[model samples]
Every structure is written in structure tokens, then in C-alpha cells.
Target: MNTVTRPRILVVGAGFAGVECVRRLERKLSPDEADVTLVTPFAYQLYLPLLPQVASGVLTPQSIAVSLRRSKKYRTRIIPGGAIGVDLKSKVCVIRTITDQIVDEPYDYIVLAPGSITRTFDIPGLTDHAFGMKTLAEAAYIRDHVIAQLDLADASQDPVERASRLQFVVVGGGYAGTETAACLQRLTHAAVKRYPRLDPSLIKWHLIDIAPKLMPELGEKLGSSAQEILRRRGIEISLGTSIAKAGPEEVTFTDGRVIPTRTLIWTAGVVASPLIATLGAETVKGRLAVAPEMNLPGEDGVFALGDSAAVPDLAKGDGAMCPPTAQHALRQGRHVADNVIASLRAQTMKPYVHKDLGLVVDLGGTDAVSKPLGIELRGLPAQAVARGYHWSALRTNVAKTRVMTNWLLNAVAGDDFVRTGFQARKAARLKDFEYTDAYLTPEQVRARVEGARAPE
Candidate 1:
């Protein structure tokens, strides 16, 4: 008689991918059959779709963050840390805990849904002059920074200083960048009413990117309509342009135009986390290459998904790959979990195949755009659909209720726009939150090993 060891599944990164993976695994697997664990830096899974709302004061910071412990009902243990490296051959992962300790955890099966990090360019002074909009910290920083800018503009004696303090530049024209600009501009408009000394006209917002059109992925017609609404609301949309240089008090664009501004938001794009490349697996554009089943090819009991994995879009012909978005990530996570359980049972695993469901872009206030099921929508009705869709998409009741309450309060009483006073006056640069350079590669690791042996 052979005694079967309980199958152990370890999910890394608690973003859409990791969280959904564990959620599905718990639902499918019997307690006696498998043991599941999730590793994440935080106890909550942040609803990234509403990050722009949080930055713009439409929602509070906690509204978008759902507690993972409260949401998960299964026996899965949550490890509070980040997976820094993986030893695929040994089936061990090196994780860095929040307390700055390194530990190794072994697993029978590993789900590499580590997600992506911000991809910054090599623009002059960008690392030192720009702010990021990727994480909770960055979003909170932007909120306080915007309010502080208004306060500074009100107090400045020199017109140039005041103008610089009031001018805001948002780089990137994707949904994230556009929504952030729209929401922040609304906050400024609402908050400046309190500062009688400040002129709302002095507050200028410029959205710049090298893309010929804003959100071309959203199809042409809806994209144009969304851009028009933003333009009508006093937003300067500079297409086919990018920042040439950034300074403490000015931003120089590729069009040979320079604007004096202290606020520079960088939201250009994202790449897979450096941890993926460390696994010594095939990678596409920094993302781990995985099969349609979300399993890494040639690797046993290993899988990846979300922004960190290059998942093929089997639904689309011509060998196309899915774009990194929350919608796809959430679905991919559930599919991967099912596959993991199938593997344990020695059953057939299913491939991840889901058609693109449409996208929604909230432009703050009663202005928005959406394309659900190939139908294009815009204006107020679209805004309602967008908010409703996102509110329903939230994972937890507490999160849903909090977000709805914030939206209702804002609608009734308007935004407070008061700076949280956290991370204020502390100028944040692009490099402060994200690292642009590639981390230690195999060659570098080899050299480090050789040096350590030779010297000490």
C-alpha cells in the first residue's frame, strides 16, 4: 500500500493572480487532499482598478484594499513577504519578509503569479523629477503632493514659482494615466475653491505620451471621444510627444516645449518583476513564458500568470499574447488554480482561454467611456456603467461597501482634497519606488560567487 503525501501548493504574490489562485484552489481542493499557501507583501489584495480614484479623492485609501485574511475562508496560510528568487531545480523559493529577513520555503507545486513592476525609461532627470502611480504608497503620495502643490501655489510670492507649483504633468496616455490626470484635475478644481488667493486658471494639467492616440487599445472611436472630453475639460493632451528632460521646477518635452512644473507623474508602462528572469526560464519582454495552461514549459509543477507571465491569447489567432490587465489577471488566476488541483489529482488540466471583455475608463465626475461586448458607450451613462461594473467586480463586501460609501459621500458633499500630510514636502523621484536597471543577472551572480571565494 502506497501512502500519498498531501499535495502542497504555494502561490507567490497576492495581486489579482495570486489571490484568485488561492481562492479557487480552496474552493476546489479537499482539506485532506492538498495544502495551499499564499505569499504576499500585504495582508490585503488591492483593487488596482480604482487606484486613480483613491489618488483623486473619490475613494479613500482603504476602500480599494481588501483584507485577504477576511476574504479567504479556507485553511490557506498567508505568508507576509515577497518572493525574491526561485530555485526551480530544488523546488525552493527565496522570500524576503517585511521585517527584512530572507527565508526559503519548499513546495510541491508553485504558482508564479508575481505580477509586474513599473517600467521607466531613460529620460534625463526623470528618475529624480517624476512621481510614480503604481503602488498604494505612490497613490497616497500623489494625493498629498497635489494638495501640497495647491497650498504652495497659494503661498508663493513670485508668479513664476506659483505657476511652477500649480502646473502638473502626467506622462502616459493609457487608462491608468488618463484616469489619474482626470481625477486629480477634478480634485484641484474642487479644492481650489477653498483657497481664494489661488486662481483655478493657474492650475494647468498636461498629459503627454509618445503614442499617436490616447488608449488606442480601446479602439479608435471611443478613444477619440474620451480624449475630446478631457480636452474640453481644460486638459492639454499632447500626443506623439514625451518628456525630454525633467527638473525640480520645469519639464522639457520632445516638442521643444518647456513647462515650469513641480508635479510630474510617470505612468508610461510596466514590465514583469525581475524575479521571473531569475528563475532561469524563457522570458518574453521580461515576462516568464508560459503555456496556454499557465504552466511554464519543461517545468514540472510550476505555473505563472498575470503581468509577470507571457500568457498566450489562444482565443486570438496568429499566436497573439494577452495584454497585462486586471480583467485577464483575475480570470487567469482562477484557471491556474483549477489546473494546479488537476495536476495533484493526476487529471487533465484545462488551458486558459477567455475573450477580451471590454474596458471602462472613468474620467471623473459624470464623464466616462466604455466598450463592453463590442458596444461603445460614452458620457454620463457610460460613467454609471463604469462605476457599477467596478463596484460589482470588487472581491469583498467590506471593500465594495467602503468604495460605494466614499463615492456616495463625494457625490453628496464633494471632495475634501485635504493633503494627508503623509509623504508631503518629500519630493519623490521615479527611481525612489522602482528600479530601472536590470537586477543581478546570471553573469553578475557568477562573478559575485567567484569574488567571494577568491577574497574571503
Candidate 2:
């Protein structure tokens, strides 16, 4: 007598979409229904919206990293690796494990939610000198680097060295760039009190974007409101401007101005993960193009979502694709899980549909702007809504407790302005955080699946 093998369902990320999809799958599917496997380098689902808080020392790194193994309901075999490539025709995924081991994983159903990487231009010294705010390691390292700058500036006898260390430049005016500059600026503002030798007046932060307006999606009124708040806090806002070149000690702007600074934090934007290119599939603006049901056209049992996929926005009807936001990714995750279940049961799959739920910008402290459900709010009210929404979105009780405790502790006692000193010897650049060149070529992927050893 022959026993039937359970169908394998592979999820290729631990981000908001992938984690939510895995959780929903585990909760709804029986133990014998299918074998679930999650492929990711880390075991935690990073709450990216609150990353600036982590970098600012308002929250610990573990507070935002919701562990995948914490759930008792989890039956998915977790693979501590990243899926570098996927072959749709052969239904195989090539993975590079954390220990430098290569493996091939075959699956009956595949969910491509590999997310995105920080987008960078060909500007000189960008890949070498710029720090990113995308990963947990980067955030932690940035905190140390920021604190180190303060320490160095305080001890420096040369006015030029001190001035260069005191100034900081942040690129991009979108939510990530704005919030990162705001939170880190607040960090320096509070930390300056601890350094007796450093002059608080010397500290400066410049926020620049190529776009004419800052966070244009927030509407003119709220956008201006946000600008006013930042300007009031002494953050220099330069719109319709971007970096022409980046140097180790300074950055040149497109508007023919050069600013001397030791730190350049790039939160400009993101493009889909490089893994999407291995499939040789159609893409819209660097994101994989998927059907409204979140499945790749003409490929059964293959699905995609999150930042890697250009999922059509059914609600917005004019050939529009959903924006790469956590809100849409979270919803799309659950919807895609339901569709996966339907596919297994031979039922019809429904299209993913969600309306714009408005935007929130946490500028650290009581300065926040939010338009939840079309209601525009600013100051204390907006701050409350923003924090509440983020706090409630956490997945587990353990995570929620840790985050709340951290928030309370921060509110009551404040930060110590100390650096961990781990990043002093580490490489903390855009290329270091995002391994954009790690994915295998399409031909190599096919060879790997066919039992041939491909070139390293």
C-alpha cells in the first residue's frame, strides 16, 4: 500500500504579508492537509513602520521583531535562509542558508512575498558612505553611529571636524525619510544635554527630496502642517532637491549646494527584491505583475504579493496597482491565504480589494499627522491615533507587552544616550544591508533544480 505525500506550500518571506499568510494558513489548515515551509533569513516579522523609533532609542530592537517561533500554533518548518531564485516551470526555489549552504526546495504552492530593498542611484560614494534605515541591524548600527558622532564631535578640538560631525543629511521626503529624520533629530536634541562639551546650537539636520512637496499624498493642508512642525523643530526642509553626489565627509546637492556632514541616511525609496528577476516574469515598475487574485498569470499554484508584486487595486479600477504599504500588504496576506485554501479545495478564488485607509506620519513625540478614515488630525490627536494604530497591529501578546513596556519606560525615564559600540568595526552601508546581487540567474536556477552544480 502506498501512502500519499502531503502537498508542500512554500512562503518566501517573513515580512508583514508572508508572516500573516503563514499564520492564517496554520490556523485554517489541518496538520495533514499540507506541509508549510517559510523561507527567510530571519525568524521574526519586522514591524517596519516603527523602525525609526528603534533607531532613536525609544524602543529596543526586539520590541519590533515579532518572533515566528513564539506561536504554539505554528507547524511550519522554518528555513533560516533567503530564497534567492525561483523557477516557475520546475516549481523549485534556490535558497542560500545563513551558514553559506545552498539548497533547493520544491513546492506545490509558492507564495512570493520577498518584499523590497532600498533603492539607490549611481551617485558617487553612495554605496560606500550612506547608512540605511531598512533592516534591524541597520537601525541598531545607526543608533550607535549617531551616538558615536556626538561623542567624537564633543571630543574634537578642530572646529571643522566638530562641525562636520554635528551636521547630518537625510535624503527622501516620503514617510520613511521624514519620520527617520524627525525621530533621529529628536534623539540628538535630547542627547545633546548629556554632552557638556558639544554645542547644541551646532547640531543641524537637512531633509531633502526631489519631489516638489513633502508627502504629497497627505494633501496640501496636512503636508504643510507637517512641514511647519518640522521647520519649527529646526529641521531644514529642502523640496525639489536631491543629492548629486555623496562624499565621505560631505554631500553635494542637485541645486548647486554642498553640505558638510559625516552622516548621510538614505531612506529615498525601495524597489522589489532581486529574486523576482530570476523568474523572468513580467513586471510593472520593477515589481512582479500579478493577477487581481494575487496569482501569477498562467502559472497555477504560484502566487505573489507585498512589495515584490504589483497587485492590481480592484477598488481603484483604472488599471491602478496597490501602493507598496504595510496596510495593503497585511490585508493582501490574509486574502491570499483564503485564496490558497480555496485553490486546495477546488473552489473559486476572490480578487483582493481594499480602499485607501488614509496615512499616518509619526514625527516623534506629540508632533504627528494622520488621516485615518478620511478624518484629518494633527498634533496630540494625530499622535495618539498613530501610536494606537501601530500598537494594535502587533501580532502577539508578548510582542505587544514588550512594545508597551518599552514605550512606558521611554516616556518615564528617557534614553541614556549610549552607544552599543558593536557597529564601530562593522560595515554599515546600503550595499552591506541589502544583498542585491545574491540572487541566481534564471539559467543557474534551472540547472540547480536539474541536479547540476552551478557556478558560485
Best candidate, TM-score? 2
lDDT per residue for candidate 2 within 1-456, as digits (tens), equals 999999899999999999999989998999999999999999999999999999999999999999888867678999999999898988889999999898889899999999999999999899899999899999998888888999999899999999999999999999999999999999999999988888899999999999999999999999999999999999999999999989889999999998999999999999999999999999999899999999999998999999999999989999999999999999999999999999988999999999988899999888999999989999999999998999999988988999899988988898768798866876678788888878999988887787644555
- Model 2, CA-based lDDT: 0.93
Predicted candidate 1 versus true structure: per-residue lDDT over 1-456, tens digit per residue? 998888788999889888989888888888888888888888888888899999988898989988877744568998887877777766777777788776777899999987888777788898888988888878988899899988888988999899899999999999899999999999988888999998889999999989999999789899999889989889999999999999998999999999999999999988899888778889888888889999988989999999999899998958888899999999999999889888888999998899998899999999999998888999888898899989998998888899899999999998886776886556677777764353445444444434444755
Residue pairs that clash (backbone atoms under 3 angstroms), model 2: none
TM-score of each: 0.94, 0.98
Task: Report lDDT (CA) for all predictions.
Answer: 0.87, 0.93
lDDT of 1: 0.87
Best by lDDT: 2
Ten consecutive residues with minimal summed lDDT in candidate 2? 447-456
